[model samples]
Target: MKYIKIRIPKATVYFTPVEIEKLLNKNIEITNKLLTQQTEIFKEGLKRGKCFIRSSKQKIREERKI
Candidate 1:
């Protein structure tokens, strides 16, 4: 009598549930830090005589070709 051997392939995942959660938390922390730094810079710019001025709109007689 001859017996046949079969092999099954196993599926591999790169990120498990715990790992994904850690990654997401780290990304959120980094983003919050960056936002805080940017806000500080914007506040300083506002105090240093930086202003947003609207440019005068000009009437265009020529039509733009799309």
Candidate 2:
């Protein structure tokens, strides 16, 4: 038997400002902070994924030249 391990990125959708105000009626300041944090997380994840992909491509090129 063979085993394969895969990593799947997970995501969560946050409430839009209108929805937050209408439904939850949370403070605007807090909601803005939460949204900012979520955006930062997404940006960081993208950076990591791009770096990994670039490194993998480089390794493949290096291997082929050998």
Candidate 3:
């Protein structure tokens, strides 16, 4: 048997803010800080993926030239 590992990049999702103050009082609502941190995480992961793709393309080009 062979195993393959793959990583899929996730795009940022748009979530509607509930206007009710009662919903805001619950722990289930995401805090602004947490949302900011999650956004940064997504940005970083996508950035890394983009760099990896560029590097791989460069390597392939170099190999073809040789």
Candidate 4:
């Protein structure tokens, strides 16, 4: 199996495609659970947020010094 490398704040994680898919699924499940448990807060017109893709890419490049 081919492995891909993922770098986070202070660590690198290696994952095969299958393992990556499983990890994403697990994250979705956990996120769903948290959202359900906090329905009231979410329903109060709170918007979900994400890092800007370009900014995130730049940050990763800076961290990796590549």
Cα RMSD (Å) per model? 14.5, 19.0, 19.4, 20.8
Could you say which candidate leads in lDDT? 4
Root-mean-square deviation of Cα positions for candidate 2 versus the true structure, in angstroms: 19.0
Model 3 pairs whose backbones collide: none
- How would you encode candidate 2's per-residue C-alpha lDDT over 1-66 as one tens digit per residue? 333333456854555556645655557667999999999999999999999999999999999999
Clashes of 2: 0
TM-scores for every predicted model: 0.55, 0.59, 0.55, 0.51
Q: List ranges where model 3 is wrong by over 4 Å.
A: 1-30
Better of 2 and 3 by lDDT: 2
Q: Give the per-residue lDDT of model 4 (tens digit) for 1-66.
A: 799999999999999999989989999999999988799676554443233666777899999996
Over the stretch 1-66, how does candidate 1's per-residue lDDT look in tens digits? Answer: 333333447744455566767878999999999999999998988766433322111122222321
**What order do you get sorting by TM-score, best first?**
2, 3, 1, 4
lDDT of each: 0.64, 0.77, 0.72, 0.82
lDDT of 1: 0.64
1 or 2, greater by TM-score:
2
Q: Mind sharing the TM-score for model 1? A: 0.55
Winning candidate number (TM-score): 2
Score candidate 3 by lDDT: 0.72
In candidate 2, stretches whose alpha carbon ends up further than 4 angstroms from where it belongs are 1-26
